[model samples]
Target: MCIVYAIDSDWGWYYFGCSTCNKKVFKVGTNVRTLNGQEITSHIWWCEVCKENVSFVSPRFKLHLVVKDDTGEARLMLLDMVASGLISESATELLNGSFDELEDPDELPEAITQIFGKTFTF
Candidate 1:
């Protein structure tokens, strides 16, 4: 067991996961389209491994934290369910809007910071 001494918010604390396969979704490029002789461009989420465009995706936590016991300290990566439980909120809810609103990944939320000094069985 160990205590979460600090959270490594400098890296980022979450991700947007594919709703279907629960895999990470990435935006590769801008998709351009023509309607009524007008052009429009939009960003989209695609799972390369899944080989499909995902219409729906939700945020999932992917946090790296600093934990320590009496002996020493170590870095830990918490993903998905585990991370969600720690914050008692879904990653999507935490985001509150499109991921584009996040100027910096390191600028996370108070819920994540609140985990500091908490103990986990790990």
Candidate 2:
């Protein structure tokens, strides 16, 4: 069993992914258009595997944890599925609770921090 003492927040905790394909999406640029003479701007994202631009994307967990065992300590990386299961919340759900554009990604939420000081078998 390993005890999760801390989270490596320096690198952040989530990534933007294609909603349909669930693959990492890259932000290309902003798209500006005139809708009924009203200016509208939206962020554009590109998914390499999807081979297309996606207008909507989802945030998925990509957690870096600092865990300790009887032997020593080590860093562990957990992706979307596993992290979501442990936290009992989807990355999108967590992001929705905060302003993603304004908030620091490194600053974790209570749901994530609660895992600290807990021991689990990996």
The top-ranked prediction according to lDDT is 2
Give lDDT per model, in order. Answer: 0.81, 0.85
TM-score of each: 0.82, 0.83
Runs of candidate 2 with Cα error greater than 4 angstroms are 32-41, 97-103
Model 1: runs farther than 4 Å from truth?
A: 29-43
Model 2: lDDT to the true structure = 0.85
Q: Give the TM-score of candidate 1.
A: 0.82
lDDT of 1 by residue, 1-122 (tens): 99998778776787778888899999766678999999976667899768987767788889898999999999999998888778867778888856564787667688787888889988
Clashes of each: 0, 0
Task: Please state every model's RMSD to the true fold in angstroms.
Answer: 3.3, 2.5
